[model samples]
Target chain A: MMIDHPLPPGSTIGILGGGQLGRMTSVAASRLGLKTHIYNDTPDAPAFDVAAAATVGAYDDLDAIARFAEQVDVVTCEFENVPAAALEAAGRSACVFPPVKSFEVAQDRLTEKDFVSGLGIAVAPYAAVATLADLKGAILRVPPPALLKTRRFGYDGKGQASIHTLCEAESAWEIIGEAPAILEGMVAFEREVSVIAVRGQDGTMRFYDVVENVHRGGILDTSTVPANMAPRLAGEAQAIAGRIAEALGHVGVLTVEMFQTGGASPSLAVNEIAPRVHNSGHWTQDACLISQFENHVRAICGWPLGDVARHSDAVMTNLIGDDAGEWRQNAAEAGTALHLYGKAEARPGRKMGHITRISPKS
Target chain B: MMIDHPLPPGSTIGILGGGQLGRMTSVAASRLGLKTHIYNDTPDAPAFDVAAAATVGAYDDLDAIARFAEQVDVVTCEFENVPAAALEAAGRSACVFPPVKSFEVAQDRLTEKDFVSGLGIAVAPYAAVATLADLKGAILRVPPPALLKTRRFGYDGKGQASIHTLCEAESAWEIIGEAPAILEGMVAFEREVSVIAVRGQDGTMRFYDVVENVHRGGILDTSTVPANMAPRLAGEAQAIAGRIAEALGHVGVLTVEMFQTGGASPSLAVNEIAPRVHNSGHWTQDACLISQFENHVRAICGWPLGDVARHSDAVMTNLIGDDAGEWRQNAAEAGTALHLYGKAEARPGRKMGHITRISPKS
Candidate 1:
């Protein structure tokens, strides 16, 4: 199917999720004279604040999804977990980016690892586990002190547990419930980094600078661009990401998380992939000419991608839960760009906002 | 009256008018985690598309004004012509930036000119005209080749006529109708520039670089930062604008347009003042670290003023009417940032959007 060329300014872009990513994307769409309609099951979604219109309906409601898709020129999602039924409906009516194939691969841990490994990208040893016998047998080759993660519907620190010993495998499996899962061998790495790359409708791809990520309590804490890794290694990460994007025939933003393994001559190992605009790319909003959100919208609208040059060195720190209470000081500080999600409550461990401070390159 | 220390995130900001300025202001406010409620009489106002809440009610509706004010932490206007009654009603419930004095001084051409002249600023020669007799008498003093502009409700070269001779005086009076007006002598100037300044609630003030503006048919066509005038003369213009802002005890953004006259250390004559974010300041959005819209939001929120230094040289060209059809080319151009108002129609002479091209400083 051929997608339309260069959507007109007044056209509507439909977004699948109404989280912070959707909110920021909608804001970017508005900047280009494009309106956004957010579809989410959650009431009072943050994206509703900035979107032109919103619908709170279950993702499985094919009727509602068809109505939404029929109303917009293009359809995109802020998260990889969009139900296949909804995507199928939207795809029938409008163009969906990162394609349904990309979603199918990213939504499952084993499939994502298999897909990256198929591209000849190095990934941690992994074996699927549908039962206790599968886990026990997989542990023989995958080794102990491995991560046992649910194959679906998991994010942040949830749906994963460490198997420190053979005795702990059953408890780990019990903790993740009866969901199909994967057992992965852990790797000793110096640091973590991610590449934010976007693929346009015509297959043109652009990558922003690599970002070094720090996690606390299994949640992203900070992302610094021009990641302290060697330039050669950063280039390698970009190549790996580009190859993955091309293989998936992906459109819109694709974030490839990698681990810097070995010392002296470091190499990248694929950690996972997020087929959407990522939290680690938030610094691009303040440090670059065109932000990841804007690039995503441009990619889906079939418009030419913008320049991705970084004019400044930047550090982005996430404000989770109670940390957002310091917004006053953040607003008062010079060089700080504060962004709050406008969530109703500050539940512990929930993302509330982020602050990006940039220093112009001298 | 003492202003509050700071407005926390999640607080509501009520904007008095809904237009492109209001839309951009709401987007900036949302960036800082603040919600915005747009109050305008027009149906489906452009600002309403991005605002959290909107009320389509007349400014003179005291009951609606009171209810809107009660829902917001602070109130600010997107234009200078906010009705005095509306201001009074909102003031009783929430803090209103720029106060009523700034509005009174800027709403009337005669009063605005008188106020600037009283501040010891050089202004074009002017005399008040309330009737045909007054126009005839003022023409003799103000001179033959001059303009007669309505004292109120005048903008974009509307409600004014050129008086070239005694024969044109009666026709000019009839053109302006029964409204009291101002007859002003023309200033022979080489170029026009504007200063965008903001005063915080705590009285701390900041000014962005002066912008040189070009007009076509009395509507702003382009605004370029770092005007081509001598640096010393630019400094003088800034000083004059700073003094006006201080005299008015103004908060939020204040723009003072000036005309540079004569050569060799050209002197500046006060042209007019906009007590809100002005079109000439739009270039700051892409060139400066903190945009005029963000500064206005900070001032009204009682947060400290942000850094206003220009990091890039910028030229902003307005996409009036059908000019917005070139959005695809603008989007494709490198270093150019496109902003559209999300307006549904492209009426002739209407400002639909703007394109700003920025060159990063070496």
Candidate 2:
């Protein structure tokens, strides 16, 4: 069916990838009287537990993607790495949010950095390394104390290697299987923060408060809202995110991670951008009036964006793996909201759940 | 498979209804990493959209109820009117919250009043009126400006009639289709309010702040938290609800609607009790640290009750029928949280959704 903007209640939203993000987005859609049809390669995807419908198929299966898309008014993704071909297939049957351009730019490290820097946003100095010859030359420009990240299919510190010096570059590249990579020179940053922003179909944009994020083992450990930064710096981060969204003509929630140098005068450099909801924005679920997941559903559905104001300061801690076993204690704690993805196993480093502790803003 | 107290994440909660309450409760269950299997009589029940599994069967279908219960670790009802036999069937396979006693008491108005009044709690003076002769005699004891309501299967102001005077008693009784009914004398009250309270499996109780309610066309129009009452009176209301919950040895959330008489010394009279999550408590979803639905899930799962502290003041307005059409306007309003049940049609008097507008506490 041909659907109009601001898809009415009862309209189905086709979601690609059925992980915790999709689970949350499904819940948000349900809250708005909308239904979600989740498409994932795995049968026991986390989001399937909350969606109205589910389709299990390979991401590159164009027929399956088209069939899934045909049943919904619009399509969106829980993860940024959705195959371009899958999104293209979905686009033939349903409107897709964040647009194909946004995903294309985000799928590669070099392209993402180039896109953001092209918008006049500050980014860490970086150079592409496609071969051993390229690596030798690129290291001179983007030197040691840097990261060699594969251009695609990298997440949670995987497909990445650290290069501490010129001599270690080759071994570091070998560690990542010598994949085409981007060499990003490390910045002397004291804090890492992210801006969770959303753009509506009408070009309206809303930004949640910048959140300070800490990563442990390359997975988001905790995110504290109202990042301990000057308001001016936070606003600048939001402005940079807005510029990126505008340049991409993006719709739905877009999260931009940044590195902040600490001192009397701190400067921010765009680290990366997630074309979907980011783990760092999970704190909004408990601290703000509207959460990133809800806003994403709103934006993708072509509805008006909600107020993204925080009511309290919050620290959201991920319960990776066995940490979820302490749920009883977390449940008993006052002022803590515990959320767990219904994953049956607690594999090491897997995000089993999260808890957000909120206190009145100072 | 046996389940222990403080049911672990991934446990299935079987809900016995599939309306908006069930939908929201299912979402809450999902947030805690719990799955929900909803059993409802209709195919298009709203809760099915969010549930992990759903069984379409009559409420009194013992076989179906048992089958659904067997797959779940625990059972709970979204509405109090669930048949006693259904609970019995479910109880055979899984633990049922609020217990059959709670449902039995709440099913009949006379039994409910007697049960509450027996605990030294003030309830509206009421009398059983099974026939015209009974109505005549009961009206003499309870008097006019009273309500003649069916003893069972009454909800949203249905199965009720108002008796303005002695002569209107017969007509009022006829209005209720002469079902086994009760005659309740109206209290001279300044406001209507309700206390949403939850009792854990261990008998621990937590009460949300009393909320003032207003009805239009016999349907809940709005519920304002921190009801305009003295703290003392609010405490009294909560204490009264606690007493009822304790008396019933209730588990999960129980709501008590009350009539508060105005004067130098305000007094509260129990209007009725709902043995499940209630509509008036919808504000908690937006304004409180933990909502009634989440607490209900926590309580029934044999987990510790969450903090019931309000972070902001809120007014929750029900979107009865056509009111949901203005979702765009509500969505655009700042500080407002709109929740729409995925109902396909907005028939008059049908609860389509609700919007909760919150503000910093005074």
Best by TM-score: 2
C-alpha RMSD of each candidate structure in angstroms:
2.0, 1.4
Error of 2 at B105 (Å): 0.7
Instruction: Give the number of the best model, judged by lDDT.
Output: 2
The DockQ value obtained for model 2 is 0.94
Give the candidate number with the greatest DockQ: 2
For residues B1-362, could you state the per-residue lDDT of candidate 1 as single tens digits? 44667887788999988899999999998888889999999886888888888988998999999999999889999988888999999999999987788999999998899899998999988999999999899988999789999999888888989988978998898898858999988877899999999998888888888889999998999998889888888889999989999999999999999999987758999989999998899887777767899999999888878888787788999999999988888998988888999898999989999999888763
Q: What is the lDDT of residue A113 in candidate 1?
A: 93
Each model's DockQ score: 0.70, 0.94
Q: Interface RMSD for each candidate model?
A: 1.2, 0.5
Candidate 2, pairs of clashing residues: none
- Model 1 Cα lDDT, one tens digit per residue, A1-362: 44767788888999999999999999888888889999999888989988888999999999999999998889999999999999999989898887988999999999999999988999988999999989999899899779999999999989999997888888998999967999999888889999999999999999999999999999999999889987888999999999999999999999999999888878889999999999999998888778999999999888899878887789999999999989888877888888999997999999999999888763
Q: Provide candidate 1's TM-score on chain A.
A: 0.98
